[model samples]
Target: MADIAHTVHVALGDRAYDILIGDSLLDDAGAILAERFPGRRYGIITDDNVARAQLPRLLKSLDAAGLGHTEIVLPAGEATKSWAYLGQAVEGILAARLERGDLVIALGGGVIGDLAGFAAAIARRGMDFVQMPTSLLAQVDSSVGGKTGINSPHGKNLIGAFHQPRLVLADLSTLDTLDARQFASGYAEVVKYGLIDDEDFFFWLEEHQAEIFAGGPARGEAIARCCAHKARVVIEDEKELGVRALLNLGHTFGHALEKDTGYSDRLLHGEGVAIGMVLAHGFSARLGLAPSQDSGRIAQHLKKSGLPTTLADIPGKLGSTETLMAAIAQDKKVSRGALTFILTRGIGQAFIEKNVDGAAVAEFLNEMRALPLSP
Candidate 1:
């Protein structure tokens, strides 16, 4: 384990927790788990993909801690976030005779985290769960917030609860197993913090793209910074009431894109978010809320990072402005017949605008389709 130590504190009164980031964190899981959860038994929920590559290390750590545990492996991907699977996970916990005081260990990417956390939230009316996020996207975003739940046909994360984890173990070393596409996808969210309220971080990422992409100390620092920003927001608003809404910068448009694409493997969540952020910037520019150059710069950086910055890049996906508009209408952020969008004036400056004109947003999407692919 490297001597790199980074911790972000999420202040939510009694519900608060720390997000710990470092290399070989999986190796230190024993100590971290023991410190956070002094219980005897734990239920580990992971997917087959993660189990094959990373579960052994986590299991070894649990054994070292002398913590009794049972592992349940589910199928990999978005499809696993269904009611049936969630029920099965709860049953697994019951079968293992887990108590409310015992911990449920989520040891995978967002899918596993969401399903396992949701299971923990409802099982026995809420049991403790630890987030051992292995994916880059999960490490910086999903793992910190206690936003746990499964998805329904209506929308992604529709059936969920705000069940914060007891502790978040972000092992940066797990990212080594990520493929190029997955790595680039996770970088999309990393870029989001800059788009929201850290212009300096945005420029820093632009300048250090090479090192960050190459996986070094610079990348670790960037991931920790992003996680810290998210933790602060989550702490302020445990639910999506006020400041927390800002964290969904690219998520509104990104979620629509994901649903329109049928949530298939063709489009990963991070890839959709990458394109959505560009669209959001463009929409902000169209409304005269943000500088057009900023949108262009963001698109350029996403391209440089090997993430898609254009709608067309997502093959067989919805291209019609009308379809996109319909999906946007179904967005969870919409309230009382009005649409709210998280727009930015510049990097590091974002605000929400309510009662946005849907027609104008449609026009912006149309224009984006006509424009040449951003480089």
Candidate 2:
């Protein structure tokens, strides 16, 4: 086995798995899979971007181990996480003749992970799958949790299932190919773990943001810590019933913005979350629940990391407040037509608030829309 830098075990009893974070995990994947899943065939699901950049390393490893597998490469982007692509992934698995015991490997960023995992979940009445997350965002967040799904016309991730992976291999080397914007986008999620409840981690990030960005020791450490934190949450609330909602601290606003942007290159997922997190903090402050300065601090950190921290940072015209409110209403966090949000008391102090007034949210959004665009 190549030296693994970090390993976080997700303890879910029968559904338990480990998230392995290190370099060359993809190169060793075939040997790893052969030992763990002997006599099982494999279907590899990935995106065109990942396939071009990293698939050969994986295929070479698999071939060396004499493992049998088929590859399905989809178009790369948020829009690829749709019903049409979901169908393509599922049909590809079926056409590959991968049986129930065979595993589906989600070998890309968040979009491929969700699409392939969802495909594995229903392909043969729930076949097991592995997460081979290539992007920094996927390595830290989406690849750890069992929540896998495609986007809906109604909202983001509205149609999906909580199908845990058999294992997660987060190869650090894969991130080397990412552009500055993509890497910065992923960093937004890294900041989120600290924002959720680890004030110390956030402070540490502030101290070492440059090191992390420059791909030093802090980068691996940050990814491992985020994975470990998420593993604990998934173990505690596998289906997002309670504390798991805290993970969506900025996602409500983020998803709405994504829908508004039509899930295109106009705004990346991490970019939306960066802006959403600021909005979440700003909204909390508006309610007199948190210190106003906290939002500004977060915005400063995100902006330094090359992320957009305000609505004005988004290019082009935004939807009306009513349009945004409509998207928020369709959020999965809603309960019986009542709004629910993850609000904060301050840095590292977040809590879920149910039965939030829609009018209050609408009013805050109206005020936000009136602010001058960020220069």
Q: Give candidates' CA RMSD values in order.
A: 1.4, 0.9
lDDT by residue for model 2 (1-375), tens: 766899999999999999998888999999889989998888999999999999999999999999999999999998898999999999999999999999999999998998999999999789999999999999998988888999888999999999999999999989999999999999999999999999999999999999999888889999999999999888899988899999998999999999999998889999999989999999999999999999999999999999998888889999999999999999888988889999999999999999788999899988888877554
lDDT of each: 0.87, 0.93
Q: Please, what are the lDDT tens digits per residue for candidate 1 over residues 3-113? A: 447888888888888788888888888867787667658999999999999999988987988889999999999999999899889999999999988999999998999
- Using TM-score, give the best candidate's number: 2
Clash statistics: count for each candidate: 2, 0
The total number of steric clashes, by the backbone 3 Å criterion, in model 1 comes to: 2
How do the predictions measure up, each by TM-score?
0.97, 0.99
